[model samples]
Structure formats: C-alpha cells, structure tokens
Target: MFTLIAAMDENRLIGTGRGGLPWSGITRDKQHFRDYTAGKSLLIGRRTFEEMRGWFRREDRPIVMTRNPDYDPGGHCRVAGDLDDVLALAADSDGEEIVVCGGAELYRLTLPFADRLVLTLLHADFPAREGGVFFPEWENEDFVELRREDFAADNQASPSMTFLYLARRAGSEHADC
Candidate 1:
C-alpha cells in the first residue's frame, strides 16, 4: 500500500521555505512521524532528502526523486529519476507500506496513488508568501477518516494539533482535482 504523511498548518501549508519548515517545536509530531515511518520505505523529493541529510535511521529505506541521474544521496538511500521510478522501487520493497515523504511537488505528483494519508494539522495559520509551499488541495470525500487525536498546545509550540489517519475509500475515484 502507498501512504502519504505530512504536518500542515491551518492554511494547508506544509512548508515555509525551500529548505525549512514553518514551525519548529513539534516534538510530539516528530515522534509520531518517526514511529509511523520507522520501518517503512520512503519516497521523497531531492530537496526533502537534502534537508533531511542525517535524520534517517538505519532501518529506514529512502528513495529520493531527482532528475539528475548522477546525483549521489551519500548514504544507503537510493535515487530515482521520477515518480514512475519511485513507484517501481516501492513495488519491489518488502515493507508493509510505502510512505510518500514530502516537498510539495512530490506530494502533488503522488496523491492519486496514495492509499492512506497520515496528517498532523496544526491549528495555526502562517499566511502565504511567508515562504508558504502548500500541500496539494484534496477532497475529504475521497477518503474515510479512520482515526483522529487532538493534542493541546504545549510549551514547545503554541498551536494545538490534530493527528488524522485517513484511508481512501474503496471504489473512490482518484481524480485530478
């Protein structure tokens, strides 16, 4: 199965800049991300991979998508030329699910193939142009929310957060919208 995971602000902003995230102090959210993706195979964009240079553990398998055929990821992580190559690698993986880790373009490109979405929604909005890179717009009707947990604002971050697990409903069409 294919899964997409991300943390976004109220405005659906997944990123604040090219190489950084908007909010920094999401300790719990970070743990959730690690726990959920630890043993899975990840498909991430080159920029995302660069931003996460040393963060990956030994057990994690990361496939970076990039157009440069000679780009070296400098670790066990592999490189793919495009989404089709990423999917082909995932198809050969032994993991239970393949996680689509981000950078806006990769998310938009793979949304149609995702079976599940694991999102952490921050309750605050960081307005656009503050380096806002959006998560692709999606329809709620396409997936069934399987679980939700709310976390109160903590010392590390001011905004409360909600963790949502959604599975694409069987028979739902995967449209471009």
Candidate 2:
C-alpha cells in the first residue's frame, strides 16, 4: 500500500521551499507523523530526505528519489532515480505500507498512486514565503475519510490540529505509476 502523509495549514503551506517547514514545534503533529510512518518504507525526495538527515531510525527504510544517479545519502538510506524505481519499490513491499513523505514535487508525483492519505490539518495560517512550497492540489471526491482526531493546541504557541485518515474511494480513477 502507498500512503501519502503530510501536515499542512489552511493555506496548504507545507514548506519554506528552502528545506524547512513553515510552522514547527507542534508536538502532537510530530508524534502523529511518527506513529503513522513507523515500520513503513518511506518514499521521499532528495531534498526532503536531506532536510531530515539524522532523524531516521535504524528500522526505518527510506528510498530517496532523485535524478542524480551518483547521489548517495551516505548509506543511511537508498536512492531511487525516478518514479519507476519508486513504483518498483512499492511493488515489492508485499503487505508493507510505503509512506510518501515529501517535498512538494514528490507528493505531486506520488499522489496518484496513493492508496491512502494521512494528513494533519492545522487550524491556523502562516504567511507564504518567497518560493514557498505548498501541498499539491487534490480532489476530495477521490477519497473517503476513514477517521479523524482533533487536538487542541497544547499552549498559546501551538496550533490546534486534526489528524485525518482517508482511503481512496472504490472505483476512483488513478493513473498507473
């Protein structure tokens, strides 16, 4: 199974486009991400993988997607040259879920093949940075909400969040990956 997981604000602001998140320090959201991705093979873009350097666990298998054939992520993770390679990895996952963790491009590239989407929606907004990265546009008709959990902000500094889980609707059309 392929699952696309991410957290975005009301404006869908996900990244600074310079290898950072627009918002940070939400303990609940971080925990939510870790819980969903644990034990899953991760399909991440090169930039996103680099931004997450040293944050992976020994059991977390990551396949970094990049166009550079010689790019190595220092043996901590493997690399995939393109979407074809990513698809093959997913094909061989057996029953293991392959989580599509992102930079925007990777999410846009893998969204079509996602069996499920696990998203964290923050009840707040942040200014869009110059060259900011936003989550790719998706149609709600293509998926059905399976679950949701709402969490109020921990303090005045944090934003309230909603953990949402959705599965691709039966008969929904998806492009072959």
Candidate 3:
C-alpha cells in the first residue's frame, strides 16, 4: 500500500521556504510521525530528504526522488529518477507499506497512488512564509476517514491538532490532484 503522510495547518502550509516546518513542539504529532513511518518504505523528495538528514533509522528504506541524473544521496538511500522509478521500487517491496514522506511536489505526484493518508491537522494557522511550501490539494471525497483524534493545546507552545487517518474509498475514482 502507498500512504501519504504529512502535517499541515488550516491553510495547508506544510513547510517554510527554508525547508523547515513553521511550528514546533508538538510532541504527540512528532510521535505520530515516528510511529506511522517506522519500518516503512519511504518515498521522499530530495529536498525533504535532505532536510531530514540524520533522522532516518536503520530499518527505514528511503527512496529519494530527484530529476538530476547524477544526484547521489550517498550510500544511505536509493535514488529514483522519477515517479515511475519510485513506483517500480515500491512495487518491488515485498508487502511493505510505501509511505510518501513529503515536500509539496512529491505529495502531488504520488497522490493518485496513495491508498491512505495519515495527517496531523493543526487547528491554528501560522504566518505563510515567503515562498512557503504548501501541501498539495486532494479531494477529500475520494477518501473515507478511518480514524481521528483531536488534541487540545497543552500550552502556548503548540496549537490543538487532530490525528486523522483516511483510506481511499472503495470504488472512488482517482481525482487528478
């Protein structure tokens, strides 16, 4: 199965222009990411992969998607030239779930193939950074919510958020993202 995972604010802002998240200190959301992605085959864009350097665990199989033919992410990751290559790699995984870890572009490219979405929806909005990275838009009608857990703000440090798990509805057409 292919899963798309991300955290976005109400405005769908996923990252700052500098390739970092705008908000921080959401402990449960951090743990949610770790728990959901652990041991999964990760399909990530080069920029996001670079931003997350040194955070990968030994068991995580990351396939970095980039258009540059000569791009190398060293020996740690397997590189894919395009979405087709990424899909081929995912196909070869022996029943392991392929999680598309993001940057907006990767999420857009892989949305059609996503069987599920695991999202952390923050209740508040942050100022949109100049050239901020937003999550790609997808049709919510195409997926059915499987689970949802709302978290109240613990302090001023983090806003309330919801952990939402959704799966593509059976017989739903793949809407172009």
Off by over 4 Å in 3: 175-177
Query: Where is model 3 poorest over a 10-residue stretch in terms of lDDT?
Result: 87-96
Cα lDDT for residue 38, model 3? Answer: 85
Candidate 2 residue pairs in backbone clash:
none
Residues 1-177 of candidate 2: C-alpha lDDT, one tens digit per residue: 689999999988899866699876888888888888887789899899988998889878889999999997986587899877876775676526789999899899888888899999999888777768998888999999999999888886678889999999999967776
Report lDDT per candidate. 0.86, 0.86, 0.86
Q: How far out, in Å, is residue 17 in model 3? A: 2.1
RMSD of each: 2.2, 1.4, 2.0
User: How does residue 155 of candidate 3 score in lDDT?
Assistant: 79
- lDDT string, candidate 1, 1-177, tens digits: 778999999889988664588878678989999999997899899998988899999999999999999999987898899766766777777665889899898899889888899999998887655667989987789999999999898874657889999999988966432
